[model samples]
Structure formats: C-alpha cells, structure tokens
Target: MKLVIVDDEPLARDRLRRMVAEFPGYEVVAEAGNGDAAIRCVREQLADVILLDLHMPGLDGLQVARTLAELDVPPAVIFVTAHSEHALSAHNSHAAGYLLKPVRRDDLAAALARASRPSRAQVAALAGLDMADTPAYVSARTREGIERVAVGDILYFWADQKYTSVYHLSGELLIEQSLLALQQQLGSAFMRVHRKALVARRHIVGLRIDSRAGPLLSLRHCRCSIPVSRRRLAEVRALLEN
Candidate 1:
C-alpha cells in the first residue's frame, strides 16, 4: 500500500518514516511538512493512506482530512497526534485510526492493518466541506501540479481518446475520469451534448441547427462551437430555452 506522511516537525516525520520502514509491502511515496504539501502529495502520489498530524501551522490535520473527504476517491487517514482529546472529532472525520503521539511500532502496525476508506456520510458531516448543496471544485493535473477548478468555471468536459479534458476560461486540463463520471458527479449543472462531451449549462448561450453537424451549441466565454448529438438535441434545446 502507498502512504503519505504529513507533519510540520522534521523529527516527528523522521520517526514515523523509520517506523514505517519496519513494515513490508508499504511504500512511502512522499512526505510533507504541512497540510498544504500533504494535499499536493496525496493528489500527485495517489496514496492509499495518509499518516496525518492533528495540528500544523497552516492547515491542521482535521482540515486536511476534511479536504480529502471531498475528493472522489479519498485515501484513508490515520491521525498520529498527542491530543487524544480530539478522538471524537477525528472519529467524526471518519478517520481510519487515531494513534497518539510518541506512537509505538506495535500501535502503528495495528492502525495500518485496519485502514479503511472514509465513507461518503463521514465526508458530508465535515462542516463547510459539503458540496452537495452547491457546486464544488475538482482537482486536475497540470504542468506545475494539481489544481482545483470550480465546477461552475468549467466550460465543458471533452473525452478525447484515452483521457477526459476539462475546459475553462483560464485553461484546459486532461483529467483522469470518464465523461460519464463528470456528468454524474456534477449533477444538473452540465448537459450532455454528446457521448464524448458534457457542457456546463451556465456556459451554453444558445443552440443552432447546423447543416453539417445537425445541432450546435454556443457557449459563453468560449470560441469553439460545440456539437450537440441527435439524441440530446431536444434536451439541450429545452435547457437553453429555459
């Protein structure tokens, strides 16, 4: 299993690293000095589990866990902290395990063995992290690193060959998800213009009947005209008319 360690203290990180080395079949993919770096590591490494600390200078461990819970496939989290008093809060975060500071090798081993993915219910309980009430953002890989683009800002999602591309006014990025997944996760905010495309209804300006393409969708803040499939033409038209 892949693992990511997040802690601000170099000594604590080193200790955890050494303990993790004692176990087999576990690869330490990356280490972060703070929650921000940990979030980046989680996205880049696709870690199976995260060894998170409860308190840090910028984003605390709970904040990090809350952020991770919002992800499509959030990794399991095990909080390694001295504040056992926050156990209930950690439990609410749906943490796989909570290991107190001055962690023993045996305790760490037990937590590792019982690691489990946080359920959607657990994520929903995280205050100010719920996106179900409104549109949320998704993380996409970029040249610099992973970036979170608001679902509202997304002009469309186009499946070009192997991967899906997310387009926005700022730029476009190739994401590791099927177009269908985007349509389903994004809910009614997007309309399926084609099997390979999902265009944001907010960005869609108008629909036009094209002699060659059959139906075309005009989107705001975008130069290229989108092709609306025959099966979805009526739906797209109705949405635009509304």
Candidate 2:
C-alpha cells in the first residue's frame, strides 16, 4: 500500500521512511514535515494510508486528519506519536491504529493492517466541530471521501433504502445522514415534500401535475422533477407562489 509519513522532525520523518521502506509492499510515496505539507502531499499523491505524527508546529495530527477527511478520497490515518495520553482522541478520530513514539517495525505492520477512514465522531472531536453547526453547508459521503456541499448548491435530498442522496447543482452525493436528520439540521431553508425527500425551498421554481405520476415540483436549475405527495402539495404550492 502507498503511504505518506508526516512529521515535523526531519530525523523522525527519515527514520520512519527508512523503516517503512524495509517493510515489504509498503511504498513510501511522499513525506511531509508538517500538517499543511502533509495535506498537500496526500492530495497530490492520493496515498492509501498516512503515518501521522500527533504534535506539530501549525496543525497537529488531529487537525490534519480532520481536514483530510473532507477530501474526495481520503486515506486511512494512523497516529504515530510519543504521547499516549491522546489515545482517546486517536480512537475518536477513527484512526486505523495508534503507535507510540519510537515505533517498532512489528507495530507499524500491525497498524497498517488495520487502516480505515476516520469515523464521524473522530473528525468532529478533532476540530471541535458539530454536524449541525449551521445551514450554510452539509456533509456528504462520496466514493472517494467526505464532501461539504453548500446549501445554495443543493437541489434536493432523497432517501433511498440504505442511503440519503443529496442532489445538488453540481451533482448527487450519497450521505449516511438520514433525510429527517438533514431536514432538522437544515431548518427553514429546506422543506419536505415527501417522506423520503426534502427539496430546497429556494430551488422551487414552479409546481406541476404529472398525468401519470400525479404531482410534480420543478426547479429553476435542475432538469429532474421531484414528486410531491398529496399531503405536502398545498404547502409546496404556498411556498412556491410566495
């Protein structure tokens, strides 16, 4: 697997690179001396995993991991640090593994064996961020990584069997967050037209009645029409006419 080793210390980075090189099948794709550099390197290299050092000059390992989670395709992060006190934070961040400083070869291998994306709680803890902070943006999970979609850009939100798909001006992104939760968090900006869907209040240009499908809601920007349930038809029209 491809790996990026991030450390503020040159010697620490060198030691890690050398040690990782000794391990079979793990290629050292790029190295960064600090969080900013690490973010850039990971974005450029698209490495499979990152050996992240917790304490750094600007953004620490926790901060770096949280930011990286927003990427289109984020890599698995494993914290390698001297501090054992950060064990809880590391776990919350959904890090694949945590290795104490003076990392051993065996431990490194084991950590790599368990690499995975940072969990929602971990990322939130790292940044002291909340999922329902405001109505400006919402988080969506794409195949590659987590993405922040601007509220204005979002056309609608639809719930499928297992996932809630956020349809936006840019495109659609599947998110694990339930549509009800989205409606609650997004507040007045979005209004639900069906039990399974929430349409952007600002995006509704007109309402239509489909002969075959019944009621339909059209958007000024989106080509696709949203099905409006009978219960919500009057309310949808009220908002549209206003």
The deviation in Å at residue 121 for candidate 1 is: 9.8
TM-scores for all candidates: the values are 0.49, 0.48
lDDT of 1 by residue, 1-242 (tens): 78999989999999999999999868899999998999999999988799999989999999999999777667889998888888889888878899999999999998986663233343333222455654467788888988887665578999988898888767888889998877777666677889888887756788888787788889876888988888998888777576
For candidate 2, write residues 77-111 as lDDT tens digits: 99999989999999999788999989998998888
lDDT of each: 0.81, 0.82
- Superposed on all Cα atoms, the candidates' RMSDs to the truth, in angstroms, are 14.9, 13.3
Runs in model 1 deviating more than 4 A are: 116-242
| Clashes, model 1 | 0
Give candidate 1's TM-score: 0.49
